[model samples]
Target: MTQAPEDAIDVDEPLAPKFVAATHDATGEQVPTRDLSELAPPARPARRWTPKRVVITPDALDHPHAHRIVERVEARGIEVERLRANRLTGVRGATERETYALAKSTMAIVVSPPSRRKLQPIAPSADWRVDLAEGCPAHCQYCYLAGSLSGPPVTRVYADLDDILGGLEPYLGQGTITSRRADRAQEGTTFEASCYTDPLALEHLTGSWTRAVEFFGQWEAPVQLRWTTKYDDVAGFVGLPHAGRTRVRFSVNCLPVSQRMEGGTSTVPDRLAGLRRLALDGYPVGLTMAPLMPLDGWREHYGHLLDLVEAAVDGVPDLDLTAELITHRFTPGSKEVLLGWYPGTRLDMDESRRTTKRGKFGSTKYVYPEDVMTEMRTWFTDELARRLPELHVLYWT
Candidate 1:
């Protein structure tokens, strides 16, 4: 048998060993008492692109947004799969990896009620998290959803946007903030909207985020709304009466990384354009310089990115911009899922060069070596301070 490349994954091959019972006991004759035993679980299918075909549960039709989604999708001449609530599992592939891929890319409108569980606390930045959706359509190679989301991460837009937004009222003014935060503009109670999925990509489909922004715009409190996106669909949000309450942060990276690793998402320039637009529209804009991979010539590339950012937001008066720096890291399970999703990807997720550390959630994640981490932090902090003096860095994690 041929050895696969260290970074390559064969999704078609099962990761676990299969078990089969012996047909004959002792002698060459078949044993009637013996039965075949199934042991190994089925292989996980590979993720494919399938955005046109949408699957909505029958209950989803009861929601107002679901009707709009169906109309908009149908207007574009797309196919809709109206499945029974229980039959939703049929959308997921059982054997072939390609079918699994399709499931990941399919747009599934879930008209389910928001979780009744208490909102989870997200310290350092936000007080609580509200889920308008579960999965993202963007097939970024190093997506965190690979491990966090369950099987076949089809993008799901909640039908109960009104209820979800209303649930945030009691949680207002209940979040804590870092006193030393770079940007005090977001100093009060904060609610994170993009904790699970990027809302911009689905904004056209569900308009949940648009409604959320409008809700926050009319809300009179110290509370703030924050969400990050790798997309540039800001047309719907530009004219909202946000009242300086919503912080729109664009997740960005160097050109090389953005073009190579972040698949099925907007280009760096487009995201920057969105940033500029939001800033110009008097919205508190921010940047999420995330998954900062330390690739070859990384400093030069990152510096260039900052330069582009400087140019994009240059002369935008009162650009209340903030940034968060997050270096690239991944858990073992996420790496496995990402590899299965994109077996031929060129992402350098080699564990040999990484340091093992337990994340806050008790999952083991692979981060860069100490020297590399230090270099990255130092370089980014200095570069941002030098190139974009107006931008405040919220934190580096």
Candidate 2:
């Protein structure tokens, strides 16, 4: 096994110690502080200011997983106030019932189930849209979840796996159901896992992803379990029972963008190393260059990235290289949240080029116009073909 280099980017250095310690304590282990740093960071600081009152409504407390998480929070020396429905109105925003429902649902299933209800039925897709958690531990400015949820950024673990798995048994038993459209036939039943949370960051605690991997291993039909993450941790997946049913995809970007926007996330080089490891372990590894930020010297930046990827796993005899690319898009609410999160974020949010969809949806006018897109597609396709001809170029969205 190839080891991550000593000089490889250390995105977890700042918070690793705290998270590691917390995890050990939660599991009832007395790990030395020094040892915790070597493994993983504690989830939060050892000493934090306690709110005068930490309130959780009755409805929120009803979910077994939510109650466990709340208990975990309190155990860490934080003062928590459990409030019934009557006290929720004093909290803020939506009604007590609405707030409780959202909190309960969000924390109910640690893993978000794949939505069988397809937004685009013509395409091949997965029924389970599992959202294991909300708010990534890593702070990436381009995160799509910013617009999808309502709350502060947090890493919430859902402890009830039996409930989640019980709900998914029916869908997994169904055989290969191909989409009617010709374009969708190639890709079938896709589970979008990393949209709201980074599966790897909290895998040590929840192990929900590993459970999914085991579940899919026994699946009879062809199911594509897609997990997209910017984390470089692969220790949990090295020898798991993945059985090729799960595609452990890494979301990558140019080095500059990664350093600037994807703060607290693993560097590009480290991520590539993890990908190489997964590939060597016989996992179906996919590469996603998503929300491809348009930056100065874009071509040169991407060129270097492609070069690094080619070199990372170039001669690996038994590896599957599937690459997917997507440009950036932002809903109005997302933009508002992003602007607030990153007051002086440098990304270009030009409006003229973007077309307004349903009044709220807004994306780049054309991340690349037809001419640019054609050039980019050709460049990427040609390079991958020349370097790794046997690999599959999954999609260029």
Candidate 3:
């Protein structure tokens, strides 16, 4: 097997293993049980760029925002291979054989990074963003992935997580290096998982997030593993080895938005209930009110949501009351992709007051002006401070 260059696994100290293996029966056949230690980790799969029978268009791979994705992937010592997806089909219709074939034929793949160009760097909050899966199943009308992914939504788990983690082992012990910095108050590094996919949507099938929860538990300085989702699948999370480091954040919208815009996603109330259950089980739970949609009666809609959140997790212990709020914005290039994906989407498409640049554009087009942002900030700050005074208000940007 060809080894990745030394810079790929750049750390001086040898780190402890962070994963363990278990076995179960495959179908009805009894499988031989062996530890992961018994076998060498699998090789990095080869990348194949086979063109499909369907007619290929230049627009398929010509995403204006592809450079951002290339930069992110290449920074990690991985190469990006752009393939023309010959076929586009809903994942639900893919047969078991087809699914297996797709998995076997691919190495590492990259997609256009989603969302508004400038994600307001809300102060250092989440410790670690965990990437459990690569795509989401739920179809929110305003989904960032619509612009990010090239084809229909299909959740893809990088089957070589063991290898990825093995590659990450050397840097795991560097937590103490930052403890010596004088000017900076050092905390654990934040792993932003689900930046490309929703962790809980197809978690039952993949069990990748569960494996992550277990892996992050053993680290010494306690890296924060943050997973956000619109799904309310809580059964897999109950009593898992989360070790108080894994924060299960639910991405919620008002009932009106949920009803009109979000498709195949859990209701806001059900997601709140899931958060409550996780908080009660001593897991760190967070609330993310992202892509804050501006529609008629918007204040009333968000007000009701605030009430629901307070009612659910007010007295719950270890509940991380740190909420994130981002308004609707889109780059011109992404707007074309998004509108193409969801033609009837009611996302604010008025490009009047947006910042224009080479490939990115977004509505600094505030649903409400600076005054509204001030008012909303004040209202949330006061209400959260009053209800849960000790809870850390991690970030508001």
Candidate 4:
């Protein structure tokens, strides 16, 4: 439950010696049992965002990114409104629940002042956190951003990305990785962009993240742009000249967990296939196994999850594979807000069954009991090591 660094692990260098492909079964009958495309899940159908209304502030009215966002959404017949005083309004609902729902589906275009965009350290993940956006459109039942963001949680994409990328130069080569060993693949200062939002989810509407990706692709520095997404919209940025400086980590979980909690997002197989697709393009890719719940038959579920991941990147020799293990933890405020957002959610957050721990800011949270945590951590660490020996487990919490 402690919102601090947990079991930071030291994984061996990330590089598979070679892929053992099934070229032939027995008699030299020309046959390859499985192809890369066959191993992955089929093409994912597009996810249509429901942010029908977009609000642009005066500061962003003249921004190119704002214009692009307007052009894209307007092409789809979504309304675009301009805010005069830099405040969003006019999204009402019949009740509190409906109000939350309405706000979640709205988009905002605003310029993040240089002062307000001061970079902050997000240890264990990256040297610093850089946000191209400030809210996510996904409706995960155990929504972590529920109580975190102020206002009505409308997805806000910053149009001042040039200024934001211009600010990262001062913090290079001073970050703490998972460890000197597990993170040898990314030997530089890292900047995580999806701490507060999923960039891919907003990439289609606002080209801010596309610009961010291009900026990192061309920048000459010892910095890696890191971000994770549950969405599988990768075609736009996959062909960019990232130069191995940007690591795209896909957030995945067992099918049971994702289907039960994660809503309006790509399926787990689709996300895994996205990772595979990026790896094939020679970009650094990672797997983030998050909100790990010890559900009934968890072993079977996670085993299948690992099998899918193995199928995802097994043939890519010399691959840069990273995994971030995150067990589910929640705060009282987040619980209250999520309950209001999803009153019938079956997520297990019973205080009596959880252990209490305090965070760096002295905020209390409830995490799984110590015994349960041990069981999950042990099984995952051992299984990951045995199954995918070359993968680096960045951390487990």
Candidate No. with top lDDT: 4
After superposing candidate 4 on the true structure, give the runs of residues whose Cα lies further than 4 Å from its correct spot. Answer: 1-44, 113-116, 178-185
Compare candidates 1 and 4 on lDDT and give the better one.
4
Give per-residue CA lDDT, model 1, range 116-202, as digits (tens): 235778765577877888888887888978888776777877766676777777876655553224355345668888988898777
lDDT of 4 by residue, 1-397 (tens): 1211212311111222222222211222223333444333344444546586788899987677678777766655567787888877876688768788778888888998564588877877877888788888898998789789876777888877767778878777665562233435344778889988987787767767777766776777666788999987776654456666778999999988899899989888888877876676556789889889989999999999999988888777457889999999999999988888889999988999999999889999999999999999999999999999998887888
Better of 2 and 3 by lDDT: 2
TM-score of every candidate relative to the true structure: 0.82, 0.68, 0.63, 0.86
Error of 2 at 191 (Å): 2.6
Summarize candidate 3's per-residue lDDT along 115-222 as a digit string, tens digits.
Answer: 322122223444223343466556677777655665444544444444444443444324322222332223355566678777766454345677677666655543
lDDT tens digits by residue: candidate 2, 260-360:
88876777877887786666556678788877755678778988998888877765545767777777767667777777667778766665655444433
Give per-residue lDDT, candidate 4, residue 363: 99
What C-alpha RMSD separates each model from the true structure?
20.3, 10.1, 14.4, 10.5
Q: Any runs in candidate 1 off by more than 4 Å, and if so which? A: 1-50, 94-96, 112-117, 178-186
Error (Å) of candidate 2 at residue 63 is 7.6
- Return the lDDT, model 2, position 245: 67
